[model samples]
Target: MNDFVTVAVFDYPHEITVLKHLLDQAEIDYFFENETMMNIAPMYSQALGGIRLKVHPEDAETVREILKKLNDESNLKIV
Candidate 1:
């Protein structure tokens, strides 16, 4: 089994959704933490440290690279 590690944390649902779509398209396995809690209590997003995006340790570098490329292309900071 692949051990997962957090690649990024996002306070907004839309941010997570955008990254999720990109990761999905890249076919990189991933999951999110604190999504339910954040959805249930959005105000706690900051206190709870936001939603976390996790990926297999082996995919960590690739995930970072992908995010970097996307951020560069869009000229938006994601990480």
Candidate 2:
């Protein structure tokens, strides 16, 4: 397997999904980790859960920036 760069971890499935969509919309590639955690134990997963959004090591920083942008947008929507 290739080395992956973890960009973000979100406990909420909605958040994880949203982030995933954002990356897709941005045309940035990513992969997920901890998918079982989202379904097996939702409450626990939400409390201590999250999906690791990963990309190629070379695109790590770019992925992080995109995550930051999505996070900021998510936060603003909450306000």
Candidate 3:
């Protein structure tokens, strides 16, 4: 995971639901840091710096493109 880099930070798990499926469909190698903790305490998201979407360095650009498309296509903007 050392090669993984943060590509996005979401404040809540609900915000990432569609994103998770998109990432899965794309077969991207990624993980959400602090997701478990955030799920346990959503109020701590700000303190924990949100749930980080970390992807392998090789897939960073692709992931970014995917995120862009997702944001452009839906009202669920993840910024």
Best by lDDT: 3
Q: Can you write out model 2's per-residue Cα lDDT over 1-79, one digit (the tens) per residue?
A: 2687776776756666666677788777677777667767767765654666778887788877876775575566531
Per-prediction RMSD in angstroms?
A: 2.8, 3.1, 2.4
> What TM-score should be assigned to candidate 3?
0.90
Winning candidate number (TM-score): 3
Pairs of colliding residues, candidate 1: none
> In model 2, what are the clashing residue pairs, if there are any?
10-50, 11-49
Candidate 3 ranges beyond 4 A from true positions: 73-79
The sequence of per-residue lDDT tens digits that candidate 3 reaches over residues 1-79 is: 9889999999998988899999999999899999999989999999999999999999999999988888785565545
Estimate the TM-score for candidate 1. 0.82
Q: Report lDDT (CA) for all predictions.
A: 0.84, 0.69, 0.91
Q: Give me the displacement of residue 51 in model 3, in angstroms.
A: 0.3
TM-scores, all models, native as reference: 0.82, 0.69, 0.90
* Candidate 1 ranges beyond 4 A from true positions: 73-79
List of clashing residue pairs for candidate 3: none
Tens-digit lDDT string for candidate 1 (3-73): 79988888867677677788899899988889988878899999989998889999999999987876786
